[model samples]
Target chain A: MAGTNGTIISVNKVRKSYYRDTIEIPVLNNISINVPEGEFLALMGPSGSGKTTLLNLIAGIDRPDEGEVVVGGVNIAALSESELSKWRARHVGFVFQFYNLLPVLTAYENVELPLLLTNLSKKEKHEHVEFALKLVGLSDRMYNKPGQLSGGQEQRVAIARAVVTDPTILVADEPTGDLDKVSAAEIMELLDRLNKEYKKTIVMVTHDPRAAEKAHTVRHLEKGELT
Target chain B: MKIPLKYTFRNLQSRRLTTALTILGITLVVFVFAAVLMMAHGVEKTLVATGSEENILISRKASNGEISSIIDGETVNIILAMNQVARTPAGAPFATKDVATVINLPKTDYVGITNVTVRGVSPDAFALRPMVKIVEGRAFQWGAREIIIGNSIARRILNARVGGTIKIGGDQWTIVGRFDAEGCGFDSEIWGDVLQLTDALGRSNAFSTLTLKLRSPQEFDSFKEAFESDARLQQFVPKTERQFFEEQSETMALFIRVLGIFITVIFSAGAVIGAMITMYGAVANRTVEIGTLRALGFRRRSVLSAYLIESLMIALIGGIVGVVLASFLQFFSISTINFDSFAEIEFSFALSTGIIISSLMFAVVMGFVGGFLPAFRAARLNIVSALRAS
Candidate 1:
C-alpha cells in the first residue's frame, strides 16, 4: 500500500473489533488497501462483512484495533481524538447512508456547517455554501429543510455538505442505501460528476453492484478480510 | 468551530412540551425562592421603619421585647429629668412612658384568634412621633378609656374600627380614632393613655418602656450612658430606638429566611431533576445530530456547552416568569406572628434588587446542576456508535 506514489489513503494491516460485555468480536482483520489521488473507489461487501467498519477507519471516525491508517500523508491512528477531529475537518468529508442532515437546519445551513470550522469570512463562507448547493443542483431549495425535500434531494444536500469544504478525501458509507432506484441512480451520478469534474478523491462503501459500477474501481470485502 | 446558538434555541422549540414543563418546574422553584425573600425583607423594613434614630428606648436589661419589659414610674421620672432628654416647644421634656400588651382578637376573616399588640402611651407620644397621623375621627382624650386603633389593625381585626368598642380585661374601651403609622410596625398596635390602659389591664403603677426624643441623634450615646451608669436605673438598658426595633426584627427575619432557604433547597432539587430528565431525552433523541457535530470537527466541549446553554435558557425564562409572578404579591398585605413578641404583624411583600438578582442566580445554578451530567454524556458519545444509532 505504501509503494504507490499518488496514494491519498494507505491502509496497512488494519484490524478493528467490537466489544460486548468484555468480549471481543472482530470486524476488520489484517486489511490493507491504497487509494490514489482523484480515484473513485468503491468497497463492496455483504452485511457484517466489515466494509462499513473499514470505511469508518478510512474516514477517521473510528480508530483501528491495530494498524496504520494514513490519509493525506498523516497517520490518523497515531493521532489523538481531538487531533483526529481537526484532521478530519481539514481533510475528510463524509456522506452517511441515511443522508444525515440535521432536521433543524435548512439545506444551505447544513452545507455551511463544515465551513464554520474554517477561518473564512462570512461573505466567503456564503459564497462557498451557495456554490456547493448549486453544484448539487439544489440552489433553488437552499432554504428548504430536510423534511421538505424529497429523498433524492436530501441525499444531494448531504453530498453538498460533504464536498462543501473541498476536503482532501470524500468518504461515503452506503450513500444510496436508503433511496429508491431512481433516486439512488441520481445520487450515484452526482458522485460520479463530483469525482470526474471536481477531481475529488472518493472512497464509497456499497452493497449495490449498480452503485459500484459508477466507481472507477471496485474492491470486495468478505468475512472481515479484503479479497 | 461552535454550533450556532440558534441551534440550541431551535431544538428547545422543537420539543415544546418538554421545554415548557421543565421551565414550569424551574418557575415554581424560583417563585418560592423570591417570595420568601420578599417576606423576610418586608418584616425587616416594617420593623426598621418603626424607630427614629434620634430617640432612645428604655427596657429591662434581659427583656426580649417591650411587652416583656417593666419600667416603673420612678425610672421614667429619672429618665425624663436627664439633661440629655430634649425639651418640646412648651418646655416640657419630650418623653413618653409606654406599655405593650398582647391581647387575643378574632380575625376579620373569621379564622381562629390571633394576638394583637395594645400599646399604652402618654399624651406626648404623638408629639414624639410626628409620622403618626389620625386619619379618621378625633384623637383619644387623656385619662379617658378611649383608644386609637392603627389603620392596619382596624382593617384586619374584628371590632377594631373607629367608633367601635373593644373589651380589655373587665373594661370596654371606645375606639375613638384610626391612626396611620406610615407602614411601620406601630401600624399593628392600638394606642391609648398609659394610666387608663394600666388600670384596665390591672397592671397599675408600672410601664413597659420609656421613649425619649433627643435634641440631636448624636445625643444617643450620652443618653444611654447616663441611664446605664445610674445606680437607680441599673436594672434597665437603654438603646437608640433604631437599635431596639432592629433587634426586634432580627429573630423573626432570620427564622423566615432560614425556612425559605430550606424549602427552596428541597424544591430546587426536584426542579433540577426535572431539567436533567428533559436534557437526557434531548440527548437521546438527537444522538445522530450530536455525532454529526462531532464528526464535523466541533469539539466535545462545544456539544456540552450547547446543551448547557439550552438548559440555561430554559431556567432563565422560568426565572423571569417567576419573578414577574412574585412581584404581584406586593399588592396584598399578609400577617404573621412575630416569634419574639408573640403578636401578629401585617406587612406587604417587598421586592428588592438584591432579591431579584439572587433568585435569578439560583435558577442558573439549578440549570447547571441539572444539565451537567447529560451534557457530559452527550460530549463523550462515541462518534461511530452515535452516527449508527439513527
Candidate 2:
C-alpha cells in the first residue's frame, strides 16, 4: 500500500522462484524493500543474485510468488495480465541492457511508440516525441535507424521511447552494461539529470560501481537475500 | 490495440527470399486450379454450342452416338411426313438423313494418325445448322465423290485442303469446300453426299441418323410423344438437339472436373505445407520483436492477426497473378476424343467470373489453414522467455 509518508513502491515479503524439470530454484527469498517518490535507487549484486528479478517485480512485468507488490496504492501482484500490461503502459518506463529498440523503426518513430498506446492526437504525439528526443540530446539523429546509430545513441533513443509517456517510475536493467566507458558515463549523467532535475523516480540494476554511485540509495543482494 | 499493418509489411520485406518463394508456390497451385476449371467450362461451352433449340435428332433406340445408330429409308420417310416438321419455304421438309462414321487421318505437322468424324448428309443438312458457314469454295455436289471438310480438319489433316483429294473406301473423293462452324463440335467433321457414302461404305440402304427442324421449340414434347407411340417408329428415339449435346458433354466434363479436383487437392496440400514452414521461420526469427510489441501494450490477439494478415497478403498476390496467367489460355485450342462419339473435337479454354472467385477463395482458404498454427505459436510465447531470446 502507499504509505502516508510518500513511499511510492512497497514490496512486502516477496518470494519468487523458477522451475526447471519439476524442480523449483529460488531466486528471491522473502525480500522486502520500499522506494520513496523521486528516489533514485540502485540494486547491485553478482550475476544471478535476484537483482533484476526484484526490479522486474517492481515494474509489474513479473509477479512475486508469495507476497504483494504495491505501487501507487494498487496491489499490482493481484492484477491480471491484461490489466498489468495497461498499468505498465501508463506508469512504468523500461530500459533494457541491450537497448531493445525496434530496429525497423527510425529514431523518431521509436520514441513515438509508447504514445501509440495513449489517446493522444497525432500533433500531440509529435510534440511529445520531439521533446523526448530533444531531452535525450538526440534531436538531430531522430531520422536514423538503430543500425545506423552507435550503441550509445541507440540507448538514448530507447530512453526517449521509455519516457515519452511520462511514466511515474523508470526501471532500467543494467543500462550501461553493453556500453563503452565514455558512453556509460554519459548515460549515468543523463540518469542523474533525470532524477535530480526532473524528479523522476528510478530503479536501476547495475554491476558497475560507477553506475551505482549516481543513485541516492544503493542496495546489495547476495545469494537471493538482501545483504 | 492491434499492431500497425505497416510493421507487418516491413517485416515481410525484410525476408524477401522466403516471401517470394512462398508466393511462388501459391501461384503455381492457383494456376493449375484455375486452368482445370477453365478447361471444363470450355468443353461444356463448345459442346452446347453445337445444337439448336428448335431441332430434334432421331437415333436408333439404345444407341449412344449417331455413329452407331441406323435408320431405314422407310422410317426416314415417316418422320418427314409428320406435321410437327418445319417447312423450307418451297414446300419441302427441313429434314436430313445423315450417316456418321470415323476415319483415320494422318496429321499434317506430326507423323501420328488421329480419328476424324466423317458425316454423310443430304442437301438439306446445311439448312438445319445455320451456324455452319462455307468459308472456302462451294458445297459438295450431290451424288458425286466430293466432300467439304470443316476448317479444323482442313488445317490439321494431311491432304484434306480445298481442291485436294483423299482416298476413302477404295475411292478418291475430291475436297470441294471448307466451312467454319463457329467453334462447335461440327467444326471437326467432314461432310459428303449421303447416298454415295452409304453405297461406298456398304451400309445397305440405311442412314445412321435423322435430324429435322421442328415447327417451334415447344413442339418437341408432343412430337416426341407421337413418335414414341407409333409402332413403326418405336425402334427410334427423339431428343431435342440441345439436350442431346448437353448430355454428351456430361461424362467428359465430369471426368475432367474430378481429375482436376484431385490434382489441385494434392498441390494445395504441398503449397499449404510450404506456407507453414515459411511462417514458422518468420515466427522463430521475430520472437524478440513479438515480445517487444507485447511489452509495449499490444495484446496477444493483435500479434495473431498481424501474422495472419501477412500470410493473406502473400496468398492474394499469388492468386491474382495465377488468374492473369490462366486468362491468356483462352486464345489456344485443344483437341480430345469424345468418349461417346470416339471422334476428335476441338475446343478452347474458357474463363468466367465464377472461376476467378472460386480460385481466389481457394487460395485464401489455403492461406488461413497454413498460417493459423504458426500464429498461435507466436501468441503463446511467454513474455519472460521471449524477451530473453537473442
Candidate 3:
C-alpha cells in the first residue's frame, strides 16, 4: 500500500439473506471489515461462502438487511436506490467473473461507458479512455470488440472499463477465475501493477489461491464468517 | 446517465427479423387508417365542390334530392322575380329551371351497369357555372336533340364519346361535346336542353328544381326566409347551394368514417400486440445487457426511456411507409353511389396534411401503449439476479 493509511471502506454488522419461496437462507451474518486506501485485498472462499454477496455489499450493488456499509464516507445502505446508483458511479468500479463487457461495444467504447456519466466533452472523454486502455497494455486493441479478443484480453478490457472513470475504489469478483494458468498469471501481474504503481484501492473476491497470493493482504471467509 | 440513442438503434438492428415484422404490422394498420380517411374526404370533396356559396336551390318540400323534387312554372317565375336574385350583365335573371333523372348505362370495362345522372338545363345554366368548360367538340344547339357528356362520364361509360348518339327515352340524342366540371359530382352527368328533355321524358309541365344565384352570399338567409314565408311558395324549400350539397354528402361520408374507424380499431389491436411481443422478446433476450447497463449506474428511468424510444422509432418508420403507399391512390378514380340521391358519383382519393399527421400520431400512441409494460418490466429487474442470468 502506497497512499495514505486511511480507511476507504467500512462494513459494520452487515447481515444478508436469500429467499426460496417462504424460506429465508442466511448468506452473510454480521460481517465487519475496514479496507484502507491503496491496499490490494483479496477475499478467498469456497462455494456458498457468501464471498460474492459480501463483495456486492461493499460495492453498493446491494444493501444489507442489517447494519451499514460506508464507502468513501457515504452510508450506502441509508441511500435511496437511485442515490445508491449515483454513488456507485462516482465511488465504486466493479469487474465481474464473466468479464461483463457488452459484446456489441468495442474495447474503447466499453471503457468509455462509465465516463458518459461525467460532464466531460467528447474529446476529453476520448483522452481518458485512451489513457485507461494504455494502462492495461491493450492500446492497440482499442477498436476490437470483446468477441474478437481472447479471454485474458477481455478481462483486461473489463479492468480498463472499471478504472476508466478513476473511481475511489475498485471491487472485482473472480477476476481471473475463467482464465487458464498463463492468462491468470498475466491478470494477476496487471492487478499487482495497478496497486503498486497507480496506488489504486482494490478489493477482489477470488476462488484461486494462486490469484489471492498476489494481493498485499488476503482474507478468507468460510460459511458466511471470517476465518 | 442514459444509454446513447445509437445503442438502442443498434440493438433493434441486431434483431432484424423481429423488428421488421413488428414494423410491418404497424404499417398495415396505418395504411388501413389513412386510406379510409382519404375515402371519406374524397366523398366530401366531390359533393361540396359541386355548389357555390352564393347560389340558392329551390325544391319541393320534404324532397331528399333534386331528382325527387318538382317545381312548377309559377314557382320558377316567382323565384326568378325576387329582387335578391342576381341578374346577368345582359339584364337576364341568372336562374335556370333544371331537370334531374338517372339513366342506366353500361360500363366501358363491361363490369356491369351503373346509374349516370342526366341533367337538362336552360341556356343560363352555363353562365351560372363558369367552371364547366368544354374540353372537346362544340356546344349543343338550342332546339336539337344533342347532349354534352361530362369528362368523367365520357371516360367511364360505353358509347359516351363526342359525336356518338345514345338512345334516351326512345330518342337518339347525339353527344356533342365533353365538358370538365372541376372535379365535382356534375362530372358524372349528361347535360341537354331542358325543353327537349321534358318533351322526350314526358314531364312537360314541371322541372326537377330551380337553381338561382343570389345577389350576394349574405342574401341567402333572407332569400330562404322570404321564400319560406310566402304563401304562394310555402310548399317549397329554399336552401343555400352549399348547405344542400353538404346534406347530400353527410350520409355517405359518415358511413365511410364509421366503417373506417371500425376496421382500424380491429387492426390496431393486432398491431399493438405484435409490438408488445417484440419488445418483450427484446427484454428477455437482453437481460444481461440491461443488468450491465444498470450496473454501470444508468437509472431505471433511463432504461425505460431507451426502450420506449426504440419502439417509437419502429412505429414512425411504419407510419411513413403507410402514408407513402396511400399516396399512390390519388392516381386512380373510384365511383360509388351517393346515398342521398342514389346516383353514381365519381371521385379520386384525396390526401391532406391533417391525415398524415394524425396517422403518425395514432401509430405513436399504439407504440407507446405496446412498449410500456415491457419497458416497465425491464426497469424493475433486480440487478443481482439479472447479472447472473445469461
State the DockQ of every prediction. 0.75, 0.49, 0.60
Question: Lowest summed-lDDT stretch of 10 residues in model 3 chain B?
Answer: B238-247
After superposition, which runs of candidate 2 have C-alpha atoms over 4 Å from their true positions?
Answer: A1-5, A193-199, B53-61, B69-84, B167-170, B204-212, B218-240
RMSD of each: 1.9, 3.0, 2.6
True-contact fraction per candidate equals 0.69, 0.29, 0.39
Which 10-residue window of candidate 1 chain B scores lowest in summed lDDT?
B219-228
Measured with C-alpha atoms, the lDDT of residue B363 in candidate 3 is 92
Top DockQ hit: 1
Task: Give Cα distance to truth, residue B360, candidate 2, Å.
Answer: 2.2
Q: What are the per-residue Cα lDDT tens digits for candidate 2 across A37-95?
A: 99999999999999988998998878899998889888999998889878888888888
Displacement of residue A99 (Cα, Å) in model 1 is 1.5
Global lDDT of model 1: 0.91
lDDT of 1 by residue, A39-93 (tens): 9999998899999999999989899989899987889999998888898888888
Residue-level lDDT tens digits of model 1 in B131-167: 8999998899998999999988988898788889998
Candidate 1 clashes: the total is 0
Model 1 alpha-carbon drift over 4 Å, by segment: A1-4, B225-227
Model 2 Cα lDDT, one tens digit per residue, B115-200: 88899998888888988899999999998999999978988888889999877778889999999999998999999999989988
Ranking by TM-score: 1, 3, 2
